[model samples]
Target: MWTGNFWKQAAERAVKTFAQASLALLTGDGMGVLDVNWGDVASVGALAAIASLLTSIVTSTVGEPNDPSAVRRTNP
Candidate 1:
């Protein structure tokens, strides 16, 4: 979590989560595009992103110390 690479990966995961959440909000229902609630979409996206970040932090303990995304380091 202290390393730049760890932060970078966390941010990437958050952004991806946000994008996916937003897309789901936009397309999941039969509502027309114009009827979509932008505020709700943004809120959901933000929440999902935060959740992703939290997940990264929680999982960091088991991974390589410097890599938040790595579950474990393998021997060569």
Candidate 2:
């Protein structure tokens, strides 16, 4: 169930996450950022799955609304 606003929000979150990841990569020392255990790996995997799902939904329903009334427009 993807709507315009949901797509926008998911895109925003993805962009922010990428930015933060880029900064972390640049600022962290050699081993500090590279360090990852099982829990961290699982968490990242879950996040990736969720992001993938959101992206798929957004792509599949580019213009449709999950709920039209929830979205505000100026042309109405």
- The prediction achieving the highest lDDT against the true structure is 1
lDDT of 1 at 65: 86
Estimate the TM-score for candidate 2. Answer: 0.40
Q: For residues 1-76, what per-residue lDDT tens digits would candidate 1 score against the true structure?
A: 7888989999999999999999998889768989999999999999999999998998888778866664786799
lDDT per prediction?
Answer: 0.89, 0.52
After superposition, candidate 1 runs with Cα above 4 Å error: 73-76
Candidate 1 lDDT for residue 30: 67
Candidate 2 residues 1-76, lDDT tens each? 5457665655555665655554554455344545745355455545654665466465544434542122344575
Worst lDDT window (10 residues) for model 2? 63-72
